[model samples]
Target: MSNNSNTALGILAGAAIGALAGILFAPDKGSNTRRKIAEQAAATQESLKENALDLKERVSETVAVQKENLGTRVENLVSDVSYKTEDVITTLEAKLKELKAKNKQLQKS
Candidate 1:
């Protein structure tokens, strides 16, 4: 599990323990205690939903940034390879020309 998951679980456990302690120590009647517990649960649910949405957005943004970085790296690598290939071709052409000139001179002699 992720750190976020662990944090969320800890929050929920603490809330539950707090609610139980409140119900046990309060002087209120059982019906009122139940109502308060229900209210607390509803609030906690809403807060958890908001936190989950925030986490999702953060993960999405991180993925987008990483994807853009990978694309830039790939483009740079391709450009480097293209320049190297052109250099190799030019070098081979020069060597071929030198060989042809030597052959022509030998034939004339």
Candidate 2:
């Protein structure tokens, strides 16, 4: 979960830094350089926004998948427990019947 977000953040930071360095080092008139810097900033901001949204979507998808898996596991466990309980009840009933028959035979004797 954190891993994906971390990678994206690192990439975005690196790109922003590299772009800034390139723009600063280029030879140009002051006004033109400032304009270029503003444009680059706006572009970087948009890219960051997009990456953030993508990260959110990926996290949501991962959570949904895990939730579904958890639900399935719980259902399976409940079904298994229900079957085992039935078997235990059947066994106990048979034992009770045997005890009753033995008691009757002893009373007659």
Q: Quick one: best lDDT, which candidate? A: 2
Clashes of each: 0, 0
**Candidate 2 overall lDDT versus native:** 0.91
**Range of the 10 consecutive residues with the lowest summed lDDT in candidate 2:** 1-10
Question: In candidate 2, what are the lDDT values of residues 9-101, reduced to their tens digit?
Answer: 898889888988888999988898899889989998998899888888988998999999999999999999999999999999999999999
Residue 32 in model 2: lDDT:
86
RMSD of 2: 1.5
Model 1 residue runs over 4 Å out of place are 1-5
Top candidate, metric TM-score: 2
Candidate 1 versus truth, CA RMSD in Å, comes to 2.4
Candidate 1 lDDT over 75-107, as tens digits, reads 999999999999999999999999999999999
Residue 43 alpha-carbon offset, candidate 2, angstroms: 1.3
In order, candidate lDDTs are 0.87, 0.91
TM-score of 2: 0.89
